[model samples]
Target chain A: MTLVTVDDVRGAATRIASDVIRTPLLPCARLSDELGLRVLIKPESLQNTGSFKVRGALNTLLTWKENGTLPEGVVGFSAGNHAAAVAFAGQRLGVKAIIAMPHDAVESKVINVRRYGGEIVPTDDLLGTTEELASRYGYPPLLPFNLPEVIAGQGTVGLEIAEDAPEAAAVIVPVGGGGLISGIGAAVTALAPSMRVIGVEPEISNALSLAMTHGEVRELPRAERTIADGLAAPRAGNHTLENALAYVDEMAVVSENAIGEAWADLADSAKLIVEPAAAVGLAALRTGAVSLPAGCTVVLVVSGGNADLVKLAQARMG
Target chain B: MTLVTVDDVRGAATRIASDVIRTPLLPCARLSDELGLRVLIKPESLQNTGSFKVRGALNTLLTWKENGTLPEGVVGFSAGNHAAAVAFAGQRLGVKAIIAMPHDAVESKVINVRRYGGEIVPTDDLLGTTEELASRYGYPPLLPFNLPEVIAGQGTVGLEIAEDAPEAAAVIVPVGGGGLISGIGAAVTALAPSMRVIGVEPEISNALSLAMTHGEVRELPRAERTIADGLAAPRAGNHTLENALAYVDEMAVVSENAIGEAWADLADSAKLIVEPAAAVGLAALRTGAVSLPAGCTVVLVVSGGNADLVKLAQARMG
Candidate 1:
């Protein structure tokens, strides 16, 4: 199977360089001191659309434009981050973005997509709705994960982690559909082969872990939702699963309570406003869901920061 | 008429090198794009104990310890940030920190000081209570700002900013007791003399601006308080005033409304959980209180992030 190459990621980096922010890695000194491990945070929450989704989205569109196959519009389905990303990127490239979103999507997510001039189609069947819309309008389907271009785009994050924290013993990444980790895995495994690529998922949303164990895609019920809405991908795409199986070294699942606690801790201690999905990697380490040896340095991909301020406040109060 | 010298700042940098965070400058792409001016953020909010005050507190204590004049106990007065800093720093040095804080101090700030093993003396008169406690207990007073040692320590931040973003057109800092900006002004004037040093204060708590205008210290009534509690210094101490007069180039005062709006915007746009005091520099730029030429780069010191989460949630809701 053809997988996302590090060269593809290098190409994507050049393509989306102007479209995306070169997010800095903030050292979590407080957490590092407590854990006796160097904790580096690549805070993509401070990214253009407040998530790493922008990299994949922008790369997918920009690649098409560069290859002279740019479509008039794109259709995709996501719980949140990917939707906003496609909307923002499509608008930037003068391509329309139509997102088939869940009825219970986060208000901010919906707002962000609209703010970027993306049209939303409310749907109970996210993937089906997106496919139908794409087919009907002859628009290209912008897969949130699983596609080679998307995976290659997301791999840019891995290239950055490898470049920024070459001494990192492991890079812990949040796995939704496995697009981010697969791309990162490919890059890190090739460039910083010494560093392990660890994937983390919410305990309930363990599609990536289940897929790796069964050596196949395993879909969860749509009703089984997680507070980390951005990480609600029920199954990994074939491309992403293949890349993960080939490149990811380990997988860990964190509890909902731990995710909540870590989310609050990250804000209070690191002064970072991160969403629940973004906090899961830190949660994995904090709760020993993904334990590393003491004194080992680990890089955590803080995927996004589209957090609800009200919820953050309530968490702090608790 | 001696002020915080560049050499003094250099010494403080060496003395407290390990004690504080070497805060990185985050390039604000969104704000820069919106205003057509390059904006960089020096987020000291992620410092140890979540404020730049730790630099001064640690430096003051470390300087004495280095000189072999270390005392058994230290006393100080503050609304919040300094109290926590001294508490954390004193505990590190095996010195007892007794902080006389206002009765209406933020609960989180109070909790942090106690968590760091400091004794709190509740008082109506912050300085008077602290002085009385220090004199009665025969302990050396740890002034929050204005002393040569403390100014030198805070000047370390200026040194970092100058070194990190040497091309900055101006470094906008929040002025409370004038220790932070005065130290920074001294360093920036000496090192990056081409770069401007702009001090920002809440309109209601404009002690630094007032002192600079009147050519002497003028104390405001303690009852008049702004939401930027960390910047509620009634007046500057003599040393800070002298330093400001010698080194500071410009001053800006922001409205209470602008402060609140900027506090929320920093979280929403930048994903930085900063306090109201830390927001005033951005507030000044946003409210057109400190406009600069288009395309010129400016650095804003995000001084602290020890904000009340519940209040933040409430603000978001509003």
Candidate 2:
């Protein structure tokens, strides 16, 4: 099997350079001063489609376009960002796009998906069950979580960290179906083996952690709650599981309230509107669930900022 | 007084290169597709202090330190960002800082100021009345509005813009005390005189607009009521006014609701948490307050992201 490597990430960086926004690596003096660790943030929140999902989605779409697999149209089922990503990528490639989103998806996300020229189909199926909609779209689904090219594309983030802060001891990534962590885990291990790669998950939806413990893919009960809808994966992907088992060092879980609190802290204190999944790394660090090595340079990959507006308002009100 | 030029910005870029984050310039394809104009954003929201205030503050404090102004310490009065900036600047310069904020200042800003080693002096003096507190602090007050060096320091933004997007047809900036606009205006005009320099102000605290029409600084009574507290300058500083008058091509005012909506749009669409002041530029463009030349490139300088968490929550909720 041809697997993703550092060279693929470098190629992705080159291919996506003009299209993707190389979101900055910011020094978190406030977080650092508080944690006594050198903290830096790779803010994927500023990426196109308001999330890092765009990186993998765009990369996959572009690769398909290059490989002639991009047919008359493309489709996807996503909570928000991934749908937006497919729409954006399709729009960029001048291909038709149909995005199936849960009926309960945020109004803002719905608007953005439409804004990017995607045909939005509302699903009556319960929230968090997206695979069925993907299969029904009449086109190959754009899987943000499970593809090799997508994972290789997302791994460019780790490539950036290694280039920018070589001394970083650990890179913490928020995991969902484990796409982000799997990509980053492999990249960091290959490029900077001394750097530890930790995956953070919302406790209610710690599918990756469960998989790690079980040493196999475990399907958790549905209806798990998390403010980080992006990270609320019900099960781990086989590809992502293999990557995690091979390269990822550890998995840590943070609570629902903790996720909300971290989200609020990111917005209020850090001046970022990160989704709950993106905040997990900070949540893990803040809550002392992970005792970082002393004086270690730590990098937290803030996954995305396309949070539900109403939920954000609710979180703020609470 | 010695003023900062594009050369100074180049020098600052090198000096702060090792310290400050090189913020990304994002092309808004969605906005670009909607409008005939090509829109680019300098996301200073990702700055070290989560605001562009750090640029000027860093330059000024460092200049003072190099010139031997480290005798006692530094002082400032602000509702949010400037306080943190001064504190950050002082800390970097290895000096003591006393930041006086109003009683109603946002909690996150207060915490950030404190976290940056600033000694906060809470004052009952209502918004726009910080002189007394500054006098009490003994340390010379670093007024956000009045300082020439601050404006000159902020001029560095324009330098970056000219270097990064030299073909830009217009540069829009959020205006508060006019320091940012003043500096940015000067740099933009000097670097690319053909580019239209525009200033955006919250309708509530449009001191510079009133000053422009009247040919003198005029304090507006309603400046205290806006959600964009950062841009709520009661009076325009003479130095800032001079620069704005000389360099700015147009000034537009955005409503409070527009600011809130812009904030929400940024969070939802752009995945950034820009404060009301920073949102003003986008608000003006979104609301069609700022007319663009057809097919021209427009650059919006998002000045900061140090939003008040509680206020953000309220905005999100309401």
Give the winner by TM-score: 1
Measured against the true two-chain complex, the DockQ scores of the candidates, in the order shown, are 0.69, 0.51
Can you give the TM-score per candidate against the true fold? Answer: 0.96, 0.88
Give the 10-residue window scoring lowest on summed lDDT in candidate 2 chain B: B125-134
Recovered fraction of real interface contacts per model? 0.74, 0.65
Q: Give all candidates' CA lDDT scores.
A: 0.89, 0.78
Check candidate 1 and list the clashing pairs: none
Compute the lDDT of residue B114 as modeled in candidate 1.
88
> What is candidate 1's lDDT per residue for B1-318, written digit by digit as tens?
787799999999999998777888888766787778888989888788889999998999999998999999999999889999999899889999999999999988998898789999999898789889989998999998979989999999999999988899999999999999988988999999999999999999988778888989999766668999999998988899999999998899999989998898877778898888999998999888998888999998999888888887777666
The fraction of reference A/B contacts recovered in model 1 reads: 0.74
Candidate 1 residues A283-304, lDDT tens each?
9888888889899999989999
